[model samples]
Target: MDARRNDVNPQKYYVKKLCKIIYFMGLGDCWYERTEQSRMQKILYAIWATLINSFIILNTINELLAFLRTDLSVKEKNDSIQFRFAHPCLCGKYIFLVLQKHRIRALFERLLEASRSVYTVFEVEKRSVWQAKLCCLVLAASSYCTLLFTVVDAIVGYFTQGIKIRTEVVLYPTPAHSGLLINLLRLLIEVHWWCIVTNMILVDCLSSVAMVYVAHKLMIVKLYFQNLRQKVISNIGKKSDLEIQKEYEMDFITGVKLHKDALWCAKNIQYALGNVYSIQVFESITLLGMCMVKMAKIDINLTFILANGLYLVCVVIITGVYFSSAGNITYEAYEVHNAMFHSGWELAHLSPASRAVVLVAIQRSQVPVFLTAFGVVVLSHNNFISVVRASYSFFAVTY
Candidate 1:
């Protein structure tokens, strides 16, 4: 199948937009073809990327220093003051930025490759187009909602309190007094913070969307096997022994090929996202606990409750979707064996070669497919539940 034939594909449309945004942020240079550009243009892009990335690095360092200074000062004046909640939040953002800076090229390339694999799957099944479209819509909605909420909260806080609210993990020091120049600087800072927050959210959405699409494809593959099984079983009384054997052999070979393709795609997903998954899992666990602690300490007010509640809910939903989709992929792969057995493979008359192929397919399907974080912790609903429970336990102890 020609992956590029789907010029109007919603999945491709959104993924391309995401790549453009990432490139515009100056986080990566691989989004476009460098070979098409002149030498001078390539050098200019390199220079621009370096300057933009350096600015982000310097800003992160300044924020980290400010956080440390404030944390120390608060501890000294009030021994009971613990910045426990803030530390992990800050560290997670820092780690993410550093990793993204260094790994953007590899990450983007792998994501593009995985997306092509998914596109191939869609080409095989016409009905899967609806799933692809729905995935794109969900991603766009999530990204827009997050951006709108962050911008609205920041604007409201700034106008009402004459203080710039950091909507993200950056710990910028507030200005001591209000002036025209100070206000403008604060506005710029807020805009920059908003961009960073938007990028972070988009990255998470992209990764989650990709995983969900893969799960959808896996489900399609499972259905194909199931259909094949039924077809084989139904042919028992209608077909001769040689005809049945030949049909079984052909179908078994096709199933084997499909399974191999699915597994390859699964491996590509793991390679593309393993490191990012590990970091995100750690961040979600720590941040949820911290947010819960902060919410408990705040007075009961509608705004406070809504703000904190939304934050926690968004975190859970995003992480939950990712883990659940990964689990689904594994589940669909493991069902292949059952699909074969139930297809009346035992009753079908097959040649020795056909029997050997069926046996191999069953053996291959026995080992389940899983998406792991850094080749360690498997991403699944069970692990997600464990993380949530652990976060609650930590919150209780700290509170």
Candidate 2:
């Protein structure tokens, strides 16, 4: 997870991680150019990915069938809450993610191309950006390690301990007893489950990166606006009033243009993640409710408690990462507006052209710019809180 000393650009660092994830997921390489060799590579990757991911899809169907076949009375308490409700909800999230693989690839492709073009600008990264990148990497790496250790212990437990259904590994419908074939199937399920988690992690990282880009741009606009007067005076220190006003107008226009570009990028991010927001908004409560209710229950098994606890924390972390990064965007956008408001633009003697340009920037900045899903659920801390509160309500009712 540590970035190489030579590798400093967080943009490229995340782009590489994204490409690897999508590649192994059986989606083609988003970073590479089309060539004969790359084409063949894509084909091979598709086949390998198809073969592995097909197992997950099949197991998901089996899970649904098994859940349905169980009687209503049997599902009331026990471990059924998770195996029946929570797991399926998570799977539903992943299913929508998987179903839009093509759209995801296209989205990544556009960003990949844009990053290549703007690599020089962001080459020397800021400390805050680097820290955010590392935070994301750590979150994802830790999640994987947790699941990996659980599976390894389960595997070892299978041979050393006894034949038992590992609530962690054998999440899907599987026989309690282990055999060579059954063990192989369980192994596949574990690997596929890991991939599903990886897919979500990678996409979330990508979203974080996109939000970071927009926030950075907003910060630039704010800084530029704050120094707008100084920059113009320094450039035309001895110029006439007319000349100075003209210089200010040009500087103001450039700032507004950059602000517009940043908002455009944010809008694109919203479009790409619209469905994800819908899923997170609508289904996260149900998922978290299941986890909380299951966790609150009087369960003697340590593994059960640990699994549900881990799941609940992971869900909160993922949702928080998405919303918190997005909330920063809104916060930063406001800073831009604040800077412009105090920029002393009104004090300057400006012609109609300069005044009109200032008004344009003011008009745009009047409405706080933030990403939203379907123009409803703003990706900010408020909605994040709302989701958690609703989940807690569900838990309280069920408990």
Q: What are the Cα lDDT values of the candidates?
A: 0.60, 0.63
Tell me the tens digit of each residue's lDDT in model 2 across 30-49.
Answer: 45344356778767777897
Instruction: Find the 10 residues in a row with the least total lDDT in model 2.
Output: 115-124
How far residue 323's Cα lies from its native spot in candidate 1, in Å, is 1.2
Q: Give the Cα-based TM-score of candidate 1 against the true structure.
A: 0.76
Worst 10 residues of 1 by lDDT: 74-83
Instruction: Report the Cα lDDT for residue 294, model 1.
Output: 68
Top candidate, metric TM-score = 2
Q: Estimate each model's TM-score.
A: 0.76, 0.81
Question: Residues 222-280, candidate 1, lDDT per residue (tens digit)?
Answer: 66667766777778789987787777777667666766666766776666556667766
